[model samples]
Target: MKIRDKILSGILLVLIGVLLGMILMFFRQGTFSFDLAEVKVTEVNRSESPIWTDDELEKIDDRFVFKTIAKTVTPSVVYIETLINARDRREMSPGEEEDGGNFWDRYLPRTRTVGSGVIITADGYILTNNHVIESAVRDGINVTLDDKRTFDARVVGRDPSTDLAVLKIDAENLQNAVIGNSDRLEVGEWVLAIGNPFRLRSTVTAGIVSALSREVQIIDDLRRIESFIQTDAAINRGNSGGALVNTSGELIGINTAIATQTGSYQGYGFAVPSNLALKIARDIIEFGEVKRGLLGVTIESVTASTARRAGLNEISGVLIIDTVEDGAAAKAGVQSSDIILKVNGVAVSESNQLQEKVAMFRPDDQVTLTIWRDREELETDVVLEEMQPIVQETQTIPENNFDEEQLGPEPEMWEEIPGDENSGIEQQSFRELGFSIRALATPEDPDRFNLYLHRVQRGSEAWNRGLREGGEITEINGNRVHTLDEVEKEITDSLKNHRSLTFKIRTGQGTDGYYQLF
Candidate 1:
């Protein structure tokens, strides 16, 4: 009976061992049957790739290629910094400044603005937007590279018409991005945008060219020229003068403007075509300004409504609204109410085309213009003329019997008011003055800032002595004058001594003269 019990125990142990082996095999799963078909999961082990396909191989190749090119071009590009200052107009009451009421009136100071620029040359020429240096505020320009090296820069020249400027830095061993022909660019081409957006230095964005030959009204009718390269790349306020490069890392344009109702990027971007920018930059560097031919005709676009009202056969093309007197168009006999259909065989569909066409010529370059007058197609050859240097006229007011308040709200009083007849000092009369001048404020300028004294009346004692308005009188009747206070003190001393003040003055380029303030 004992032998039989031992044999039974051994059989039970063997059965238990077989059950454990089955459970272990189930957890190790390699093959599974889905309704009778085997799905060899093969236990992937997650980290190791069990299958390789041809499509995946191609994607891997493309990614590596793009990554290589991106890494190569990044080092060659750079970021620029520009500092601009302009008049900040804010009115304030008397005693706001230390020099509360001087020069017969109290004053307010101007303000400063800061911005960015782009480096286009290795030996130090940089291109930027004109609005960056709008005011007489052209100081503290700097250029920085991707490696964090910074250098000082100077304004070489600026063109307000195209909203472009040139800057120079005194540095060597720099990288210049390759410039490509923008004329060869096509819509839907891939491009990259590089700029300092919102002070974030050296950022790059990518997009496709959405359009070409875009016309935009930058300024309100005063001066407008349109030549834009539209792209989907995002651009902002600080992106002016940035590079819009092709896939090959060749610069094709300068990112300048964006179309957005909210004053921010909304998918549309505009760039200055590189061909035009190259010409402008060359001219500015050589001539210290841009010199281009003008057609002298106020051009307009023919809309469907205008075509209906005017009974036009064709609904497209630019119309000559008015030819400037004594201008190229005027000399060529182009008249108002005439329509311009083409130039050099290129169809002009809008007024902006006329500007772009004419700007392509130099002062002496002549071009053929086609027009539609009286329903007849006519052609005329015009000899372009160089635009002369513009002279800005200043204002000068008559020094009539006046008080101090109209001179701009001065609290200090010297004489009693004489009813409404005495309407303070007259403003600067631009036609009579012949110079652009403004007062210097305390904090804005403070040091070596320029100020103009009252002008020398034509028949007054000052003019008879050849003393001019710009003349700087430092001493009166043997009394010294430095600040405006000294000027007042000297005048008081002269009045106290009952003698005319003989003033020693500094003139143009430090030429000195003497005049008696009788």
Candidate 2:
């Protein structure tokens, strides 16, 4: 009986051990049964395998790229503050003497303006917009570096045509910005604008290059060079002199202006291309001023109508309206009505682009201009000359006492004609052209008839073509037109013949001038 009981116990112990082993195996594998069909195994071909797949390598974070650029570029941008003398306007009692106003006003008040700039040289050469330091008072220009070190800055030179200026700070070991090739920048490429906007230092804004070779006409100077890089960056008044850099943290442009109605960012901002800005900066440093080269020709963009008139196969290139007498273009045999297609192998489609391209060179630099005339493409080598400063004399006209009605009965009869239809021109309204002229006696010389332009419409073709109010027309189509009848007849004949009407006129300053009415 004892032996049988011991055998039962041994059997029970063995069964319990076997059950524990099965439970442990089930927990380890997380299943009681294994199915080969439920498993997935990828096969590798070592001969065709790459160390890393293209998709895996391309999954770089954009945040890392932007952060790297910011880290590299922000150190080169600086803040500029200018102090200008302000004019005082204090009202005085009526009985007070004029001396009272003059004495106090002589003590000019100081006004502070803030801006941004980029360091281009390690030795402390900085580039900024001219307007930032235009009228700054003596000993008032200040520059602050990234580390908050402030120093007094001196103006090296300024070029108003390009709205650029160079400044120098008395500092060494500065981080200078790396300039990139602006010509290689394309639309849709990412860019960053760094500046002190609204007095906020180290402000950064990101955008894409919206366009290239844009002529915004923000600069009021007649010789303004505006091949701007248009961006959607949020640039404000204080950002005018800041740096517009690429993803590589290389400077490509200088933020200059914004297209806004509220004096703030409204989606459109413009920058001066780095190539042109650097050229002007270098010229200023070397010559103490901008050494601009001139082609010496008045040019206009080719429109469809202009293309038809000039007999061009395509509506492109800049149309040379007139060549300056004895100038580089005239000496190069460039004639009026010729279309300039290229400058130094680069195609130019606008008058401003041609102007900018030529302005990039110094005086006496040789340039090859591709011109289209009589349906033939001709290459002409032109040695540029230094552009002479245009000296314009201001004239103030006195209010006239003579009435239009008193001088009018004959003028009224002339006005009865259907001026628009008789000329057989389309969309050519005399008013839309932006000028109104009246046949009047030349007060200085009554014997000579003069057509005085009393009203010049703003933004009109005439206004844009540089015609000003108070100018006098002396001839039409190269013929002396002393009377209104002769002037009308000449315009009618030219329009009927599909010829552009040329005018020989006198400016408000009594200087002789030539203009074309198309």
Candidate 3:
């Protein structure tokens, strides 16, 4: 029996040795028919996606390959040339219009500014920075393609909220930058900054997306709309309105601003999120204006300090400060003290987050605002409001109270004339601060104020609203503006919206003081 057991054990050892030998043969002899030789035939059919080109693939192996990538992506990028007629002082006295200090400078272009833009559409809709058309006072804006050809550009519309402007050049078959999804962008993702930095066309710089939704100062407006994709790319003056593209040359952002005290290229740069810029540009092209939704709530970021003060268990989310009276917030029951946790289930951390969310809506569209109130979370429906037309109030001579101390030159022919009897009516309180007006005494009670209709200049905000010579603003608004100071304060306070001043007025004595919301 012992001999029989030994024989079986020996057979088992022999079987194990044979299995080991088979395994080694399988690995050494192109096992499973998937060796490198077979892999090549499979790849030839698909081009191995992305790295299909030898140069692109070789760079990936090198770990320091941005040149080949940039060269391939640079052509689709565009260079924007802006013919800015920036209204600036040239050390000239009262009556001298020194147009760029030369004969051609006067009649020809005064300020020729060249920047960059990404041609988003093939048919000539160029995406650029609002500051690229910076002045909003351009005599004409021109576009020069990657090709040397130049085309006259038209400002379709500008969204100062995003610092994006869409220009239309009458050219077809134009190369548009590839568009990318910003939602897919992550911190430390590779991105390329391509533009005419300091007027150098088609210059490309490489960097990574250092951050997202970083609030930086792009302008001086009280509203801090600096929710930008931060990158370490070398962005400079002429780079404004250029393209911040991905490795594939897809447009992801419109490079708009930089953080340099010397006004030159700094390590950091900002870009208008292309997703937002495109949304606004499309609207401007189709409807002549950006239709961003209004939530009517003033929001602030919940910092650690604010989070503790506000009793927030977590130190993130947006705090609702002031809900405009009778506006969307008021209607939505969003009170001043409530903290906003999210919008439509998306967490909001700052005003820019809320603003960006709201901007996504169209007028009349409803949105759900998630808020924490009294230690309880609640969701409220808010109806988005249309952005009322806001025309900038320009500087005008105040007929009523001219600030003689602050006066510049008044069209030289104008010296102090003997006070005309009619001048008493022009001496209203608000006249000297860049607005024109007249005053009248109420006939019913010689002491009471009356509607004084006068012809305003063509470019005045009142004129833009179609104010006529015979129109009488009867009231100063909800308040009485018989004095010019009252009128000025009310207008200045509500400069952001379309609050018209009403005058209790009629064409004749039967009328009363009327108002006009300028």
Best by TM-score: 2
How much does candidate 2 score in TM-score?
0.70
**What TM-score do all the candidates reach, one by one?**
0.57, 0.70, 0.61
For model 3 the TM-score comes to 0.61
Ranking by lDDT: 2, 3, 1
* Residue 321 in candidate 1, Cα distance off native in Å: 1.9
Q: Tens-digit lDDT track for model 3 on 349-425?
A: 76576777777778888999888888788899999887665432211112223343354433322222232444344
Judged by TM-score relative to the true structure, which candidate is superior, 1 or 2?
2
By TM-score, the better pick of 1 and 3 is 3
* Poorly placed runs, candidate 3 (over 4 Å): 1-72, 89-109, 136-139, 220-224, 391-518
Q: Per-residue lDDT of 80-169 in model 2, one digit per residue for the tens? A: 999876642344554466543455555777888889999999999999999999878789899999899999999999988899999999
lDDT of each: 0.64, 0.80, 0.67
Comparing 2 and 3 on lDDT, the stronger one: 2
- Worst lDDT run of 10 residues, candidate 2, spans 408-417
* Candidate 1 per-residue C-alpha lDDT over 352-410 given as tens digits, one digit per residue, 9 for 90 to 100: 66677777778978898787777678898888887655431011122234453445532
The top-ranked prediction according to lDDT is: 2
Residue 24 in candidate 2, Cα distance off native in Å: 46
